[model samples]
Target: MKKQILTTPDGESYPILTGTGLLETCGQEIAALTAPCRAMIVSDSNVAPLYLEKVVNSLKLAGFEVHTHVVSPGENSKSIAVFGALLESFAEAHLTRTDIAVALGGGVIGDLTGFAAGCYLRGIRFVQIPTTLLSAVDASVGGKTAINLQHGKNLAGMFHQPAAVYCDINTLKSLTPHELADGAAEAIKTGILGDPELFAIYETGDPENDAEEIISRAVAYKSKIVTEDPQEHGVRKLLNLGHTAAHAIELLSNFAISHGHAVAIGTAIVTRAAVKRGIMKNDEGTRIINTLKRNHLPTDSAFTAKELSKIATLDKKAAAKDITVIIPETIGRCRMEKIPISALEGLFADGLGEQV
Candidate 1:
């Protein structure tokens, strides 16, 4: 198994174990941690039948008293109601702070379970067994846990780091093409943020055969940023590169669009806006759009600027008068620009690569 240790800005550290067939070793890994005698496996309905039993058996063999909770799959499942229910499950199971929570699915499960762990008894240790490429490369390592609201995406969230993360490449085999594409969008985003070499791979490499290396590189990139700024108080905000507009796009569509698709469109819009402002060249914008298109991601939205602007105000990244918008300086670099909230509508209109 390949291992990477993530160190927080405060010097705290956790290990990310990446390799094929690491699910069977989850129990042993947990035992190597603080050794909680009790654990709760939080998974989604789509993943429960496939690998939940294997994880449970592994935990049991390692002498852990295990309880399980399976949530319905999809973005909708990451809700306050679901989060509340998971807390209730923890209470009913008599989980104490010493007990741990194991998130055994994709990005949704990791976010929901991590939020549950953070709030359960004011906070408890949680492990991330990210089954999706997106979670492994981005969401699982950040300590940013969130649930969506009716008004916008990730309106309610907290920063609670996991005790450990086990990225079992074996899980990728079961994912649908859409799932893989969804994750590739994030990896591409990481490449665009830094590491031009990584960006080159996304443009020309076969992701299926190179999943492990690509995921590891992305994780390492994010880990370095998180180490420098664990919170979004500074450099970390750059990680929101395509997310500002992406959240608005997701909300305006009532989440009919998946996050990866939304991000693709968001990045394209931001790139175009940068081009219009002469911040990024026209060729750079074309490269970003082509990359997204080549990856089977979307670069267009049907919503008008007025509709998306209203949703943008509710984004967690937005402040009372300004929203921190991330723009690409070039394909492999980006910068944060705090735009006045009043100008958001215009930015959205301009970002569409058309006249308002």
Candidate 2:
């Protein structure tokens, strides 16, 4: 196993373990997080049916008294109703602070379960077993947990880091082609933020998959970023590479764009504009669009400039005067800029001309 540990604001170390066959090794892994009071393996119906048993069994063998709860699958389920229902279930189980919850699916499980764990008993411990490429590369590592709102996606959430994240690439074998593409969006963003060499892994035009070395390198790439800024106060904001406009598109789409796809489109939109302003090379931005296209992901989504502006205004990153965005002057470097909403409008418009 290739493992990287990140210490949080409270000095708690969270482990990100990347490899094949790491699923059944939960026994030894969860030891650091709890005293084995009780464990709830929260996941979605689709993922629960496939791997819940293996996960529960692993925890049981590790000496934890385990239980399972499965949510209906899809982005729509990330809401107040479902979250309320899950919280009730946790209370029914009488989970204590010593008890840990393991999110056993993709980003949805990680976000939903992480949020619940953050709130339950005033913040208990949880482990992330990210099964999809999108989750492993992005969502599962960061402490950002959120559910959608009537107005936008991920509007209600908190920054509660997990105890450990288990990234087993073998899980990607079950992803649909589109799902695989969704995760690659983040991998590409990793390159956009920094790591041209890591970005080149996709140049051969192969998809993100159970490739051992590639998965480990991607984990390493993100792990370094997470460590430098565990909380999104400074350098961590740079990790938002393609998310500024991505979130707006998500709001306009009614949360139709999966997290990765939204970011993919956002990257293309911003990169294109960055080229126009001499903030990025035109060819580098083109590379992003080509790579996303090769993976069969979106470099653009349908939305008017007006609606995009509305969502941008509502972004949590937006404050009194400016909206902070992480734009790459080029690969291997990113800077935070607080740009006016009007300026972002023109910048975003240019990327729509071409796909990344």
TM-score of each: 0.97, 0.94
| lDDT digits (tens) for residues 1-356 of candidate 1 | 67899999787799998897778988988999966488999999989999999999999999899999999998998998999999999999999989999999999999999999999999999999999888888889979999987766777889999999999999988998788888888888988899777777778778778888888899999999999999889889988877877887877777788788788788877878888989988887888888888888888878777777787787777888998888889877999888899888888788885566
Model 2's alpha-carbon lDDT is: 0.80
What are the runs in model 1 whose C-alpha is more than 4 Å off? Answer: none
Error in Å for residue 86 of model 1: 0.7
> Which digits, one per residue and each the tens of the lDDT, describe model 2 over residues 290-318?
88788787876697556676778788777
- For all candidates, the clash counts are 0, 1
Q: List the residue pairs that clash in candidate 1.
A: none
Model 1 lDDT at residue 140: 92
Task: For model 2, state the Cα shift of residue 317 in Å.
Answer: 1.7
Q: How close to the true structure is residue 328 of candidate 1, measured as C-alpha lDDT?
A: 89
For candidate 2, what is the TM-score? 0.94
lDDT for each of the candidates?
A: 0.87, 0.80
